[model samples]
Target: MQPPSKPAPPEQQATEAGSVTTPVRGALASLSLAMLLPALGTSIANVGLPDMAKALHAPFQDVQWIVLAYLLAITALIVSVGRLGDMLGRRRLLLAGIALFAVASALCALAPTLWLLVAARALQGLAASVMMALTMAFVGSTVPKARTGSAMGLLGTMSAVGTTLGPALGGLLIAHFGWPAIFLVNVPLAAVALLLAWRYLPADRGGAHAKRPVFDHRGTVLLALTLGAYALAMTLGRGHFGARNVALLLAACVGAILFVRVELKAPGPLIRLAMLRAPVLGAGLATSMLVSTVMMSTLVVGPFYLARGLGLGTAVTGMVLAAGPLVAAFCGVPSGWLVDRYGAQRMGGAGLCGAAAACLALSLLPASLGIPGYVAPIMLLTASYALFQAANNTAVMGDIVPDQRGVISGMLNLSRNLGLVTGASVMGAVFAAGTSDITGAQPAAMIRGMHASFAVASALILAALAIFVLGRALSKP
Candidate 1:
């Protein structure tokens, strides 16, 4: 099939070479800050979990919901909102989303009860979804294609720093002030991003002349319901669904079918699913999900091992875990160079292989290895995570037509978050289900369980790599 015919939108085309404008860079810088804010809260909150339960007098379930609610909202809204940006205006959506996110963050910080906190978290998620989707679309629209790889790399690094630093900052804040410090941290940053964006980012052109713009409401509803059901099934199917789990799983399958149906039929489709028939695009997304699952598994299972099983202090655990992403922040910009040289395909394969090896090391970690021994494996895992992320994102966006980037971004980004949630649930199931002969005094049981979990993680990553290989081999660039 001939590639989608898209002469650059006249509004965006540079008719003639022009002098440099500092404001565009200023706009990107502001966007990078706004994009990083959501991550800060997410990573930091992991460390603040105990404090949250204590302050809110909340049960374990309430705390889980707080995180889940935020993720769920993001998962549902991101793709649809990205499509909204494509139709309405990327800059408009981005600035408005930032404003909404700021308010939600404030409400979260001020929340008096667990339910109130959950509600605020959901609001935060929706707002974040909009911010993330539009900012990415805006980046693509604003930058020349030749420079897109590098632009995306810097943006990825910013996000990595936010993600990596979140916990360390949270740990420090909780130690010094209290739990609310986490949400409060976004205030100044958000204000700065808001002000800079208002002053710098160029106005969008998509809806400038349309009196009655078409909205893809059917596609949006189908996508939301699909993801919502899948989230529910995953949440409940972890032994909670019993005999009905299969039915719930089938329901999720049905939702996927319906989502595709709605997308194909909508006047303004939520996602151009047919476009993603490209094997390269498919590979990129599959690898993205795998890498996401692997990284998120660490966030989920690593804490338990540090705080309880091995008896390390929570603060120390957060710091130790932060090592990988901290290193990744430095590595992110360099990854763009690698992607340019080796292609995202090779880089993704290498990343998965490295992660698999890291998992193997963790699986085989001997009791005699001690602290220094385990650090290498952990760092390798996170670094490979860093490697694949910048690369995989490039590959996906690389193959897509410019106009469809937001939809691709939304779909791939959702896949990554879905992987994040699934990782926790999957590893949790693995940890909870398996019996260990080694407990109290005998450490073998704990080691065995951790090893099995790592091995399972490795298998998942490998599966993703395999899909990438097959899909990429089958598709044209």
Candidate 2:
């Protein structure tokens, strides 16, 4: 026989292994739209709050619920819906979610009263929870294991793009069409996502003889209640903590204890405690939360420093704020490539090191250097964040058993959400304390607040780095 033909090139081999299959590309498109719509929903409405309040004849506080209702529903119900998807079927549930989201978006656009709009937003949030939680879970089945990092990176990029596009797009839509246009835009996007998902996502694999998993109703209710209470405690009253906040926080703690007690005894628990005991999964979630907290500091603190301290105009401040997500969107895919080449653990550590360095630079750099100094560090921080997110998600999802993927993905999203909520309150408070009165603070005071806030952020990054290192060491055989 003739000598064996030379092996295929890496790209061809990857294609043969199904990474670039038509069905895989279709599935990825479906997942990308799913990720994008939720992120767009989250940020797009903020720019239209004034218009909404004027149209609905409501105060700013009442109009704010149009946003808060959506956020609260997603934060509370994400894990419960994910578990339900595992018991039912992810594909079927995702299709239902997309359909529901489309309907809710239409309702939001047509609502005549502020309360009605808020109710529609709540419903939309429920749908978004399914899309967000299940999209990452579906990644395991859609793409080859070798390309997990790439897929994760792509999803991250889409998320960043949605966030970056929302304010600008919403402004244009509202200026020309009205506030409702922002919600109405989601309808067509959801239809496209639904069609792709229906056509290409792998069908749920189980026969009539298959023993379906039981749903843990008690655990689900308790978890939802606990999370709702905690979210309310963190978000209500803006940044000022009060007696009501304390009471709500205490109730959440009690609810959490009850939830754990119920889960431990349930025959079919919503989440198995043993899974969290795994060092890699636990560390990944913890670091995700920490990194998210640090990242949110940039949002909460950056605007004040840029506008008040640096004396930038409104348009300039907005442009400067957009740069972080822009850099993150561009870096996400390359970061995934690095993860695939260098391994998740190594890439994760390197990302954390870079993040810590960037945070330190932000803390120490003088305000005299102005926009360039601030922008440079923020870009570095965001790029590093993209690398860490890709590596962490790939590592966590790489080996999960198929049945548990939905809940695990939900937990990952939940951790990041909670961190964002916490950072908004905690970091805002830290900056407020440093400045004494932020509204009338001098430039020097604003600089002080910025320094203090970033110093704390740098500490948070170091803590995440420690957790990552410790987790890897313990995960070793």
Candidate 3:
């Protein structure tokens, strides 16, 4: 007779069963905070811009750099920082990033000059890029593979919470403690995150004897410059593309060509071109960008539609606009749970179908049905987006090897950010083209613009769905 084996250790059992143990919980809390801080940093300052401009004696155009600097820094450097984490150590880099973020937040809070504050914000963005990139990278190492979607969902929830909380929290803080309070809030949160990460997160593997790949400094610089140019081209003119925008865009195109050439010839490339040729990764990135573009259209066009088309007051419009993100925030965890239950590829397809249907409904139904109609479709769109995000993130990150997680995670984030930038430009243009003098347009013109915008959005969602299906087909042997 064979003897019965002893039960696995509590930690091992919990992992095997895909349950969150104490250690896993702590790690998740740290990662969630990491994700949240960057998101908060992105949105919180928007509410304080007026105060900041007044205090610093800067014009609105110059003050806008306070936001732009941070965004540009993140967009330009995210992939490089992710690669750095992969080369050095994610835990080490992430801890350093958290510490740096706290210091930069203090610098922003204390800066006396506008440009100084902008510089500090840029520094803060650099740290945020590391945090954002590495937090997702750390997921595969921290949780059981079966629970990757759940972890991703939790991180998504934190991101939505931070984004949603930022405007409201910043308003209250500014009213009570001034604009600096917005930046100062991050200090304590970062400190707590630092402690949690130091104590609970897993240490990096390998030792001094393990061989490490060479850092691609040339590729990094070229890619950063390329991305910076592209971001500037997309963002500089605020909705109206001008001569400088065209010049920057052209420069970006040239820089991209040079970057690809440099990367291909390098002995140890920053990004393996072959990896992009793989149907799954390439299609994942493309679909992510497409989906993000559609999502951003709602933000770009929703306010105008509510205020002009429906004749809602500013307060009511704001509240109605808030509903989309709130739905997304609440749906995040459940969406992840569904991804885990049904599998990422399947859930991803389901989410895309739902999104397409919602977009079509928004395009056709909202004018006749009014606020309830608009709100319902927006809610469905956001919920579908949350599901798609969770599923897509899981599908992409779940199969990545540990060595490449950081860079791959960075690529995923980069794709989404690029989509946002493009959406703000292209979708805004489409909306504007659909209406004459958008600010003073009549209800009919506003409705027409809204319909045109959502119709385009629906098409984008359908394209993403096609890409998803094609990718799955091609990935099969």
When sorted by TM-score, best at the front, the candidate numbers are: 3, 2, 1
Query: Candidate 3, residues 1-477: lDDT per residue as tens digits?
Result: 989999864435656878787888899999999999999999999999999999999999999999999999999999999999999999999999999999999999999999999999999999999999999998888787788899899999999999899999999999999999999999999999999999878888768546788899999999999999999998887678999999999999999999999999998788988899778889899999999999989889998898889989999998999998899889989998999999999999999999999999988864779899999988989999999999999999988888899999999999999999989988898899899778788999989998899999999999999999999999889
Taking the tens digit of each residue's C-alpha lDDT, what string does model 1 give over 268-321?
676767777788777777778777877776766676665555667867876777
Candidate 1 clashes between residue pairs 3 or more apart in a chain or in different chains: 438-445
Question: After aligning candidate 2 to the native by TM-score, how far in Å is the CA of 301 from where it should be?
Answer: 0.3
Model 3 ranges off by over 4 Å: 1-17
* lDDT on C-alpha atoms for all candidate structures: 0.74, 0.92, 0.92
Error of 1 at 329 (Å): 2.0
The residue pairs in collision within model 2 are: none
TM-score of each: 0.86, 0.96, 0.96
**lDDT score, candidate 1, position 126:** 92
Candidate 1, position 275, lDDT:
73
Cα lDDT tens digits, model 2, 1-477, are 899999954334544595577778898999999999999999999999999999999999889899899998999999988888888989999999999999999999999999999999999999999999999999888887778888999999999999999999999999999999999999999999999999988887668446877889999999988999998898898778999999989999999999999999999999999899899999999999999989999999999999999999999999999999999889988998889888999999989999999999988879889999999999999999999999999999988998899999999999999999889888999899989999899999999999999999999999999999999999999
Q: How close is candidate 3 to the true structure, as a TM-score?
A: 0.96
Best-to-worst lDDT order: 2, 3, 1
